[model samples]
Target: MPPPNALQLLQSIFGYEQFRGRQADIVSHVANGGDALVLMPTGGGKSLCYQIPALMRDGCAVVVSPLIALMQDQVEGLHQLGIDAAFLNSTQTLDETRDVERRFMSGSLKLLYVAPERLLTPRFMGLMESGPVSLFAIDEAHCVSQWGHDFRPEYIGLSVLHERFPTVPRIALTATADALTRAEIVKRLALENAAEFVSSFDRPNIRYRIVEKDNARKQLLDFIEREHDGDVGIVYCLSRKRVEDTAQFLCDNGITALPYHAGLSSDVRARNQTRFLREDGIVMVATIAFGMGIDKPDVRFVAHIDLPKSLEGYYQETGRAGRDGLPSNAWLAYGLNDVMQLKEMIENGQAPEAQKQVERQKLSAMLGLAETVACRRQTILAYFGETSAPCGNCDNCLSPPKTWDATEAARKALSCVFRTGQRFGAGHIIDVLLGKRTDKVEMHLHDQVSTFGIGKDMPEAAWRSVLRQLLAGGYLQTEPEFGGLQLTDLARPLLRGELSVQLRGLPEKKRERAERGQKRSAASLDIAPADDALWQALRSKRRALADAQAVPAYLIFSDATLKAMLDAKPATLAEMAHISGVGAQKLERYGLEFLDVLHAS
Candidate 1:
């Protein structure tokens, strides 16, 4: 018999009837021995672009990944599909690694995952030479770019795959990259001639919301209680202490939360991560160190209490939510302190001056996204060089923010900065603006300046908003030494009456209440009231099975797959085979168990 084609293999092995967006084209290209550089969004079926091709081709495909947990998860999922896959990482002992190597040499495995660090070792290179390697897949390909959010020094050496095996088809894939990073990836990966497939960077299912931080912890609690109670989510904090504190705060408030960070013991981190993946409704509050290769599909929300340093980092982190294409939220609460803290970190870092400039630019872009009054989706897409219509799903579109002509206020703010000799920070400047006779004002003698008490008309919050926008708009900059606010050349125009400013007004209380009313929790969005019991039953069975196997519940079947079963109500094993995620292997393993639940219901 002839080998199965891409579409046939997709259905029989992966159980998806059709390819999404550009998967078919990519699969055919790579299967025919063409190099490809694919830029796709998270949860956009990027795996199938190479997985199907690996099965279609002649020999084992070598996958270079950065994270060991990611490799283990993917290999486990593949094993459930009856595919011969394995990984060689530090977690494996000598015997286990040798077993995988033996399988690779014998051509019994279809795909072998190894970290970039190990893939470049001389021994591993000789092992590759002894086998009929079909292709090379570099996952998280953006790490090759120095400017990328997750820069892995080892990824830069992956270009040797092309140099050594010029005839082998190589594919590089990443979920987030701007034009500059894309160019750098091409240059660093030696994929100049590879076929580039860039998908739309829009995740319409995620409703973006950014609010000015007012009691950030309280705001986070309110958000969870109001829209996402009993849901699985990820909360990101910039510091390990904050991660621990926030997780405890949520737990104290009756939420099931766990803390994960680099500071935790390796055993503790691994245990927390395993619980997060295997259990339901677990909120993992972590630092950036925790989320690179998490494959959970039912994450309903991603919250950020502290501001991310760059828009790329923010996008990649938020993309973790709604992997099943369900309604989710990317909620952020940021304030002036976040901005100052991030700025100070960047300035005080040991990076070179040129790199520091790039960091500053990226931070400015992130601030723009947070402070913009336009559709958040549109702004994000535009940053990625893709034009999109207003999605009408983000906070700005749902309740357009009020903007006021702060031209006079901006000039006054700038004058205060200049009059203070550009030696004071926002707090002192604000104190001077409000005419507060604080000790700092008395020490600085700022109470004698002409602009000291001229801004008492506006509230302190409004004045802070103006300064933040000015910093975001390039009218003001922070000094690297003292983090003091200083007027920029752009401020000359505003100070000279050549430019006008319109700052976002404070969020209205009525609008906030209305937005809350409009948003339905993840529980109420897709499942009907009548099917809630059945849905819970199906999920419970999945959880029990996953627990038995010591794998993530989604590995057994994704939430999307479970929902499909709920909708189809398949009553027999044969009918269960027709479900989207139920391939032949899964039908044999899990079909009857699920059918029993459906029949009982």
Candidate 2:
């Protein structure tokens, strides 16, 4: 069989017709003993770059994944494809671990998934010495960088893989990495000479929307009721308590919602996560702890109740939705409070001053995106060093917001901060500006200050907006000790009337167009309405098979494959082999049954 080339293995085993983007080049490069560092987006078929190489190589490929759940999921998916895969992690018993080790030594498995901590152990190192290892695949390679959002200390020790087995090819893959993180990955992974494959970071299918937070819970409810009813989505909150509260709120209002956070019991979290992945129309309300290894392809929306800490975190979190290449949404509600809270956290954290500075810059970029009146998609991609035309699907492109020359207003807000002795936070400052002669203001004698009541022309929200923009734009700074707002060096220009500031006004709520290319009509996909029953029956059958095997339904056949089968209406097993995702093994195993369903329909 000429040793089964990369494309051939991709089609015959994985059942995909062709490699996506640079997947073929990556597979062949690694298969031929070339190192690679791949910076591809989520849902960009990153797994195939290494999975195909694992099949084409001589020995089992070892994948270092961060989470045990991720390993189990990938192993189950591989098993359904009739591939021999296994993992060694704490979840397995001692005997089970030893058995996987034996299989790896004997070359019985094509791929072996391990955690970084376990892979660096003495026992595993000994097993590596006894085997003819194929290559090393470092998944989520961004974890190696200290500056990355999901940094793991254990990942720092993985560079020994290259030091020990210099001949074995290594491939590092990450879904999100800025310029700094990419350089750090190359240095830490010892892949300085590896072929760098940087794919497009744009997820055009996701319509980005950032709304001003007002009656936040009501606003979230309105968004869900309007666009994402009865669809699978993820709502991200900043804290565990918020996750629980949001989940309860959603369930109370008749939405199927579940909470996932580090505070929950392991059993409860696992159960909730399993229910979310296996079932349909489940909205997982989670903190940042969740969604790292989730492979669900049908998430319709990702909503943020509060602002994320950085652009990288925001990008990664929002990337979880629309993995099926369908039109989805990334909606966020942020306001001055979000900025204040995040600044407080970062300022008080124990990280070194240098790291804090970097975080401030990243947060500032994220805030800029939130306040941008231009295309949200362009702003996101520009942050990642990619350029794109304005995507008309985003909120700003669909309905642009108005901007006002708030230079005078900004000066007034900064003066309020300065005149208040730089001791009071934004709330008190806003009160003084709005001419509120409250007890706190009177007690502090802020009402008697020259800046007090001078800003009565602008509304309270508008003033807050101006203050937040000043902070984000580096014209003001927050004191973590007392949550006080102070002027920064950058504010000198604006304070001295040397620089002008412009603030974006909140956009009026507009009727959003129906999400484009979200759901393909049966007729459009070549499946007649009369055949809908049969198509659903096929899905039901696949689900039953998956449940019987205790695996994800996608492992049996992805939604794309089922759609292809529905559209093609193959009459026999031989004809089914021509489907995009139908490999020889799948065709032989269940193709006849699918053909039978089509014939009956």
lDDT for each residue of candidate 1 in 91-174, tens digit (9 for 90 to 100) = 999999999999999999999999999999999999998897999999999999888888989999998998999999999999
**Candidate 2: deviation at residue 304, Å?**
1.3
Candidate 1 stretches greater than 4 Å from native: 521-524
TM-score of each: 0.98, 0.94
Write one digit per residue (lDDT tens) for candidate 2, span 1-601: 4556887888788787788888988988999999999988888889989988898889999999998866887888777678899998988888998899889988999999999999999888888978978999999999999999999999999999988899999999999999999999999999999999999998878878888888777778877877777778899999999999999999999999999999999889888888887776899999988998788887888999999998999999999887767677888998888998899999999999999999988899999999888999999999999999998778788767788898899888888899999978889999999999999999999989999899888888787888878877878888889779988898888889998977887554433334323322210234468878987799888888778877767677776688888878888787799887788888887888788778877
| Candidate that scores best on TM-score | 1
RMSD per candidate (Å) reads 1.3, 2.8
**Candidate 1 lDDT for residue 110:** 95
lDDT against true structure, model 1: 0.91
180: Cα error in model 2, Å: 1.5
Clashing residue pairs found in predicted model 1: none
